[model samples]
Target: MSPHSSNDGGFAKAAGAPAPQTIVTDAEGLDAALVTLPGGAPAYVARPGEGDTYPIVLIAQEIFGLHEHIRDIARRFAKLGYLAIAPDYIIGYGDPRTAPDIDAIRAIVVRVPDAETMTIFDEALAFAATKGGDPSRAAVTGFCWGGRIAWLYAAHNPRLRACIPWYGRLDGARTKAQSRWPIDIATALKVPTLALYGGADPSIPLELVEAMRTRLKEAHAPAEFIVYDGAPHAFFADYRESYREEAAKDAWARALAFLRARGAG
Candidate 1:
């Protein structure tokens, strides 16, 4: 099935909704805008300084595509001195921001295939290389749905130095399109991965998380999974109700250390 395109119409926040925060300010040196991914998907890219090669970090979005929250994330990474690129993996599908509710967002997400999303990620990596990024030192990080992709990408691309998957589902009912779960690919991973999850997330059961840990142990995969005591899914998304500041801050610190230790800095 062909992917759906986002319809511009929807209930956008009122003008009074809090103004979005800016995370980076190298105005003269930074380049910020949409760049085309392979297969024509559009991705937002942000860089810290001109002519300086920096480690690349692909910031995968939640089901929301490259919305303001995701954009802010890219800027935050840029401020940290990495070239961060966030692609609209769902460009072929409808926009999650336009969805009236969660069901509509899920409908769009389910149509996006793992293979297709990986291709877009590859494109984002290529785009980063052209903008002064060290391709050999690339890393990826994501939230929620993007988190699962981060794990799969580590297995898919051997050049990746590290991966950080935040609050992603570890196991789920299989579908024809999603042939392998993160646990299924753990043994084949070429890079180290750190998975941060919420202990109380209903969407991802604690049992499944334990199963993933067991599989990783048996395979001796270079992976680590941490569960925050009372956090819920999307705890890192400061814009939503699920945001848990304490857990999110801790996870972010761990993620940075994980990536840098793997030579992504």
Candidate 2:
């Protein structure tokens, strides 16, 4: 494991105690479990509200692994009447939380092959099925690095009903295993997707977003991108400095509506 500091640039320390806002109420019955990935790595799983079959929405983590914020996201979805699960796709890699700085996190992320991440997602889908999730109605959503994975997963899994990628980078220098960009697969998507982005995000320029839109239009993919004018990256993360409540709320409403339209709920 990489030597991690409790304080890092992109990653935050895990919450020591629950926050007072009360985003999810019926979360008592939900238990966290560990599932073995295809490569025998252990990944965390959070079950649905009442342990009943519900349409599943696979939650992907940010550069940070399954931290408190990501876990809360799963519970928040359960409160919305859907089964949401997030797996630790970076299980074999060093824990991002333990990394001493953002550079360490970035190094770990770069070393993680896209193919291996996708395989873990497939295992997450199988794990979701055991928790009473309807695989046929499964959808996927992700933030930051996870957002890029959301797009890749949509292309990889034809069974997906919908997808939402939040503030993920649209373009980057291609690696061997990460040859395909989102634009490359935009038109080949079988599932509908909604991409939420921040117009002010320097990491992901608006021009790239526009290029992705053009590709989606050309391919006739059921995909849409929304940019919040002044919001920066990670605007939806309330615990972070980039939180934009109004924009986050609006984007979340759109995401829920999009999922419901495609039968994810």
Task: For candidate 2, give the lDDT.
Answer: 0.78
| Residue 255, model 2, lDDT | 94
Write out the backbone clash pairs for model 2.
4-98, 4-99, 4-100, 5-99, 5-100
- lDDT (tens digit, per residue) of candidate 1 on 15-60: 1132333222332345566667657998877777555799999988
Q: Ten residues in a row with the worst lDDT in model 2?
A: 1-10
Q: Model 2, range 1-265, lDDT digits (tens) per residue? A: 1111131122344322333432432355564444566667565555543647888889888887777677667767876767677877775777886766677878878777889888888988887787788998899999999999999999999889999999987778798867766777888987889999999999999889999999899888888899999999988876666778899999999999998999998
**Deviation (Å) of 138 in candidate 1:** 0.3
User: Each model's number of backbone clashes?
Assistant: 2, 5
